[model samples]
Target: MLSRKEIVSILLLLTAMICILNAALFCNIMPIATSYEQLAQQTINAGTAYICILYALSTWVYHSNYSEPRRQIRYVLIAMLILLIAANLAGLVTVVKTLFMSDLSEAMDMRDLFSSFGYLCRTVAAVLFVITLLLLIIILIIVTITACNHSWSISSRQDSKEDLP
Candidate 1:
């Protein structure tokens, strides 16, 4: 049976895989872009999807590690994961709509709207990813400082013992 952490890690991995798969499907099924704007939107969506994958995997690694972070930090990470999944789902829906679009002219006319939506979703995901990374860095710094202090105290105690008459 999997532990809670293992379960969470599996879920994260699955979510990441799903995001990447959706992006792959988009790439495979999408018609060649008739305009630069359309190409840019496609590139951004694909890029953001890959970034989401990276974020999910990194978070999973952190969750799997033995060094437990604070409960609040873990909660924050979970919340971010949920938000990222939501954004990816929205992107998936946008991709589907684009794929089944009936008229090339209609797609072109709506290119600006699609591009804006893509930018918004990507920005949200990127911001969350950066925030998560920052939190990880802060945790690492705290852990390093704590370890250094612990080792210093131990060494100081040893020195005092050697000095005892």
Candidate 2:
């Protein structure tokens, strides 16, 4: 039977797949830009969807222990979690800004509001994507350093035991 972590990882992977599919659909439906504003809006939506998919994949990797260096996994996990939280907060900020703004109704019609909101969301998601990428790189470095130390310690212990005998 799979462990709880494995189960969660699988679920996350599934979610990531769904997000990817949705992103593909969004890209497919994107209209040819007649103006700079239209191009920007489409680009933002596409970028946001892609970032969200990447974030989901990162979550899966963290949960699955796919390449986790055993000794440093906990620290890596914690750091990744912190970054994920920040990313989520950025997304939340985008939503709140779009939904609760006093001038939301006056800004544009329904279609315009949606496009504007998507653009803002994309901006936040891009920031989140960068943070998540940084977290992954940092964790990989920590894992490598700790793995080397662990191996060195084991070898030293074996040498000491041989000398005692």
Candidate 3:
């Protein structure tokens, strides 16, 4: 079996790659933002990017501590991976839709190619992204506090040992 650190490393790498791909997809969709609706989509994309960073940071903090419940941690990480994948897939679909519509509009000499449905899809993805980020933030806070307590207790024990005759 892989060690805890190794597992964390792998998960972090996967998270990083997913975030990068998601950002790339958002960037690809950015050039067509010429209206308020498109601006809202861009805003959502920015928020999702920030949340992705928070998720990554939280994952690192939670996984670095060995005292946390391994099974629960594994489940949480797996859930996060699934959610991120779902969101990325949603974003990918939106990008494809936007590109296709843009092409069709261009060929037809139309002015706008964006669809409300695509915006809704992007909105759903952003919601998922925010949910995962919130979950990770909670995990990070709990793990950090637990780690501090553990270290404090260990230090007290060592000090007591040093005082023994």
Candidate 4:
């Protein structure tokens, strides 16, 4: 099995890629200030990018063995992951609402290829976001448990050594 650090690195890379793609999709959809939904999507993309970068950097620090075993990095990572998941869900809901509420007759006119492409990209991004969120959650849980068990084992070993005559 891959180490926690490696898993985190991979997840962070994937998260960053997804966030970048989502940002690009939102930028192509419509002008940022044109609608509340569009503006929110842009904001979500930005926040996701920030959190992903932060978590990625933190993972490096955490795995470098320079910090205490109970560092706050894990808590921060969990919080950020939750935030990212929420933002993705919001974006997904907005996209689904737009898709359903949009006028089909106008869409069928085929006059605006960019608009159609934007919607397609948003749909694709939303699906990816869901998959990434699930992966992050699962990885986070596993990493946290592994870290806890590792720390416990180390402490127990030290205690046993101290008790040796």
Candidate 5:
């Protein structure tokens, strides 16, 4: 049961964190002057992006109610819940790859594979994946603010009306 102010403030802070983390992700993953190992490190170290979303969702649930929006909130919550699960699934993939398909992970020698088309394709795929992850962060921030503010503003008006009577 967060006070309305607390909810707004928390959401704002989460939005800021999302923006910063996304910038870091983009900076590290994009085809810059950085080494290939730096890009790999960025991918492997991208845990904070998902964790922030999970915590923000948890905060929303604690503060939100069914009266917030009978239909839209349900749909939105379901979608975010799915995303949280998917993020965990992705993390599991990271762990599995670490244990099984990690031959080149140590050597990172793409000299042989770099000449192959598949390696280039895979690198592009990973870069796009990180871009999508950043997009999700922005989406969550927007959805949270729009939904919460709509309900909060309406409630404020009703409070004023009740006070007048």
Candidate 6:
């Protein structure tokens, strides 16, 4: 069985990886903004990136805290992630809505690819954001329960030892 510290460390590392991926997606993978449509797309990309990074960092710091009954801490972390995901997604949706109805009169012709790409990118980002948030919650619950059970078992053993000759 993994020690409490080991379990906690693994969770933290996972959280860090999540954050790093988000930051990379935003800073590296996202395209540069030009027109309103591209700008909207880039904004969603950046927002989702920031959201994931914050969620991971927050979960790492929040759960498995110094105190026991880590459930409270886990719940808080989950709530934060939920709010972040919701807010970022809302922004992405707004950007997409605007992009879809953007003033494309300047175009000498109409093409589906240019304006709608942002929608697809943001949509993918939104889905990934949800997945990461859910995974964080699952990880937190698993680790917290394991640590709490370990703590209880150790305490029980100490009680038995103290009562002996």
Predicted structure with the largest TM-score when compared to the true one: 4
Compare candidates 2 and 4 on TM-score and give the better one: 4
User: TM-scores of the models, in the given order?
Assistant: 0.40, 0.39, 0.41, 0.71, 0.42, 0.42
Model 2 CA lDDT for position 161: 96
lDDT of 2 by residue, 41-68 (tens): 3344344345445544554554443433
RMSD of each: 11.1, 9.2, 10.6, 4.4, 11.8, 7.6
Candidate 5's displacement at residue 119, Å, is 1.0
Error of 4 at 50 (Å): 2.0
Model 4 residue pairs with clashes: none
Worst 10 residues of 4 by lDDT: 105-114
* Candidate 2 deviant stretches above 4 angstroms: 21-68, 102-112, 115-165
Q: In model 5, state the lDDT of residue 32.
A: 40
Question: What residue pairs are clashing in model 1?
Answer: none
Task: Give the residue spans of candidate 1 off by over 4 A.
Answer: 31-68, 99-165
**Per-residue lDDT of 57-158 in model 4, one digit per residue for the tens?**
766664555445444566566666777777778876776666554566455643343466776776776676676667667767866776677667878999
lDDT tens per residue, model 3, 1-165: 974344445445444444444344534343554544344444444544554455556555655445446445544555654554455455545444444445576566332443565455455445544443444345445444545665677689889999999
Compose the digit string of candidate 1's lDDT tens values, residues 3-97.
Answer: 44445445445544543443344333324554343344345445545654564465445554342343444545545545544454444444445
lDDT values of the candidates? 0.47, 0.46, 0.49, 0.68, 0.49, 0.51
What's the CA error at residue 122 for candidate 5, in Å?
1.2
Candidate 3: lDDT over CA atoms? 0.49
Mind giving the per-residue lDDT tens digits that candidate 6 earns over 14-72? 65555345434532333444345434434544554454455445545655535554545
TM-score of 1: 0.40
Between prediction 2 and prediction 3, the one with superior lDDT is 3
lDDT of 4 at 13: 74
Please list the residue runs of candidate 6 whose C-alpha ends up more than 4 Å from where it truly belongs after superposition.
Answer: 1-21, 26-114
Which prediction has more favorable TM-score, 3 or 6? 6
